[model samples]
Target chain A: MYMVAFLGPNASYTHQAARDRFNQDTCVLSPQVTIEDVFQQVQSRVAKFGVVPFENSTNGSVVFTLDLFADIKSRHPDIVVCGEAYVDVHHCLLGRGAARLTDTSLSSKTDSPTSSGQATPTSKVPYPKTPAVKPVVPVKHVKKLYSHPQAWGQCRDFLSTYLKGVERQDVSSTSRAAELVAEDQSGSSAAISSAIAAEVHGLDVLARNIEDSADNKTRFFILKRTDCLEHQPMHRGAKVVDDDQNSFKSLVSFTVNHEDPGSLADSLAVFKSYKLNLTSINTRPSGLVPWNYIFFIEFKGRRENDGATGAVNAALRDLNNVAKCWRWLGSWESEL
Target chain B: MYMVAFLGPNASYTHQAARDRFNQDTCVLSPQVTIEDVFQQVQSRVAKFGVVPFENSTNGSVVFTLDLFADIKSRHPDIVVCGEAYVDVHHCLLGRGAARLTDTSLSSKTDSPTSSGQATPTSKVPYPKTPAVKPVVPVKHVKKLYSHPQAWGQCRDFLSTYLKGVERQDVSSTSRAAELVAEDQSGSSAAISSAIAAEVHGLDVLARNIEDSADNKTRFFILKRTDCLEHQPMHRGAKVVDDDQNSFKSLVSFTVNHEDPGSLADSLAVFKSYKLNLTSINTRPSGLVPWNYIFFIEFKGRRENDGATGAVNAALRDLNNVAKCWRWLGSWESEL
Candidate 1:
């Protein structure tokens, strides 16, 4: 049996990604509380493979995932991301079988998240209070919306157009939101969850595909211990490898030296001169230093490819001149 | 008098930073609930200036600060960061005057936050419970610990060495954490908060400067509306500009072309060729595209300086060849 770990609860997006990437029949999957746990479990050999969210089309990058790379590189250098999976995120408003919520219950905490994330500005002298929190007047129809905080951004249009002023209560997950509504047995409250979660929690689907944009998709990375990948223990590993033929892609994470200007440009020139097609480029805090950044770049072709091999060699050589540190995260075929 | 906004409460790190940056006699400061609100309030002219946390010496960058620049560039193109201040973060373990929490109250929700932020992970098939939540062998000494989530990282050694396995509860702010402990009135419960907060909330400091590092410092950015800066409505504007002694620094936020491997490198080359000293570099998701990044670079010298002016022009021109978008945030003297 193969053991895999992903950001969990059985009905989460990560779970869906894991099921899509790995066959459930032979895989024993575990859910980790945090992305760090997912990485830790894989590093500690508690699970052969780990699955974590990389980015969401609507909500944007899963920053902690990028931040964890610094920790992982320092502690667990033997692990690497070897595969990927994508899931179309469709949000459904799920509620209890009951019809309406009590007026008092509907009026949830009126305070909206005003702070961007960290510090809020304050004054010793009370100036004219700025119209900050839009006194969220509870809508008569939908009084409370229970969903993941990230869901609020995705269902913006639906919430404003249909259920304006509905108080949003952020929960652990969409599934948890469904559980909360189910447990509360409140008709007035609704949760934006997955259809699978609605069914699992025995909730009525109030609305389906309520996301503002249809292109909402989340990408997941399948990671494995470097040693496990080389030995190829499981039959599934070979199957996954066989799916992608001679064509493959690689991830290069590097930090450019701030002291040297154009150093990063020259390094990129190596890839340009070699005619490598880059699919994506992202930056994460090096975490080693306060403001320095580490760039994560995904490009077409495998390191083993003749042309790609030459580019990798030249880029590595040139990058040494411009980069403070660099690493080859992994080379894997895009299963997209 | 100039109106400024900062992160809430009278003694929060942001509040302290604001008081340090702006003259209290001439400035009326308003506390915003979130860092985002501070930016939004300043952009909308609700406040003439805003102060928000930029980075923590030990913890790392205030990522949303970088993320807000993306939103500000889109919504309020006229606002710019004008100044900065640094505040030393000193954490104290505070408790109620009543003293001593019951072992029961201390163990009240034994579930530790497994999720990094606010989410929890669950499994489809509940495996044999892996002794997840440690049965807190609640010692009569200390019942529980309450503090901001960030505190857990900073006081790692202290917690592991002294409060090993003591139940930890993550609150909104360290000050809020103190408030909670004070409200609990349980002598057993403790909060890691600022010394000022402990006094404000009427809590006793059980432990002072519990942070693992001695030099824990948080930097704050002072922002102002573009018109306010140019018009010099307040006497302070000229004073701020004059203090810089004709030497100022500028911030440029840009997104490199993914199609061009060396595009970012080339832009940096412009800075190098012009002999401009780059102060700091950070990157955040553009949000316009998933996983793609917009780079924020800080360099010494104002836009008017020949070397700085030439670098900005050359970088913009070269960047246009290989960038999707580019923006100049603002320039000011290094307050340090």
Candidate 2:
């Protein structure tokens, strides 16, 4: 059985994405504290693949992971971006389960990510009988809500309406928030976390889908060490990245060659000539020099393909005229 | 008295920087739980100015602050980036002061930034009677160390050599780490925090300057409300940012016109044509379009200057050929 790891305390969004993307029965999904730890585990051969968050719909791209990719490309041969997965992030207010589930009819117009099979309760506290589509939070009783900072930002509307004036404490991770509430078990304290965290930590789900945006989702990248790509079995639940699939994506990191005007535009021109569609673009410090930067670009197409291979070479040649250094991070099939 | 706020729990690096950059006697300095809180306080006019971490020598830019700048630009007219300050970070192992500063001679080759006026120690525990230059930590006596994640990262070298295998826990801030140690008052518990924390919390500096890097430093940006910039007084420890200073920096955010070939290069060319020396460049999701990004470029010279104003107008005119949108965040003197 292959071992896979994700950023954790077990119930983090990364953990949920890992479980959803990889086979939990065949692969041992371990959790590491930070994103770098996930990368290190894959590098050290302790895990065959590591899953890390790449971006979020509401909060935007995860720059740390992107910066790490830029850093690793400079040192290691290059990590392989094996596959991609999208996890619909559904946040819940987790409590002690002491209060019986209430307001079963208060479900979102959009259902929770996982529980279509069962009708889930939207809130534990009773509310005024209004035929509103959205659930109303019981503002007075919720004295405090604990969660990651991102969670607080995502749930601002719910917080303003239901938990307004309530003290919110930011923990390191959502899972940590659940863990804290589980340990404390105070009446007024609850956590905004993944529904799985409530299960893992033996907490109660007071409300479901509490995020301000119904379309909250996170994208994750499955990465493997460059040296051990071949002879490796498919990561339990991950799909094979086929070159024929239009879903394939190639990630490239490069730096501008000159401080001249339009230099950055020149490097990006290669992608246009290749007829590539960029999915994301990011810039991070080179770390070698103060104020220097490495640009990361993700475009649709596999490097292994005939058309892509030629485009890759052509782009590299053209970019060399305007960029100091460039490296292909990897190509993977990311199914939307 | 002007009110100034910083990210803190009293002795956080932001708090230290705020105190050093603003007059303590007149300005009422306050501690905030999050960086956003500082920004919000200043934006809401609750505080005349706020100080926030901008970049770290080792960790690179504090992206949150940068992202916040991009965000606020679209909403507010643009908060003025008034002045910059550099604080040399010095980490210390703090205990209850009950341990009797065992190795009074313990100190790193680099001392605390403010302790240069005093004699330095070279060891925390009783060592061989030799004139050693480096300070040593009594790792054998320490069972656990609490600190912010950044603190733990900065002090890895000391932890590995002297405190190998010791349990480490992450808190919100370094000051919180000291607060935890003070609350527990346990003989085996220590905290990696600022020297000022030990003094405020009545803890002893068991070991000083435990950070791995010798030149550990953090830079802070002083922020002010948009409407109040005209009548604003020079912050106590900060120099007035004259519009005419050659050290001025202009922060601009823009996006490529299209995914067409060389689009990004074309947008950057304006900088070169304008002869703007970009001191730093960053990229963030434009937030308007998925995967589309806004590039943040910080360059030497102010937007108000004759040369710079012409350059800005020229760059904007030239960039319109390739960029979708652009906004000048602010300009202020950032002397070396």
TM-scores of the models, in the order given: 0.78, 0.77
Please tell me how candidate 1 rates in CAPRI terms.
acceptable
TM-score of chain B of each: 0.79, 0.81
Error of 2 at B145 (Å): 3.7
Question: Compared with the true structure, what per-residue lDDT tens digits does model 2 show for residues B114-194?
Answer: 222222233322231222123343334566888877676667556655555678877778899898888873456889999
lDDT scores in order: 0.67, 0.70
- Cα deviation at B173, candidate 1, in Å, is 3.5
* Lowest lDDT 10-residue stretch of candidate 1 chain B: B127-136
The two-chain DockQ for each candidate, comma-separated, is 0.28, 0.22
Model 1 collision count: 24
In candidate 2 chain A, what residue range of length 10 has the lowest lDDT sum?
A124-133
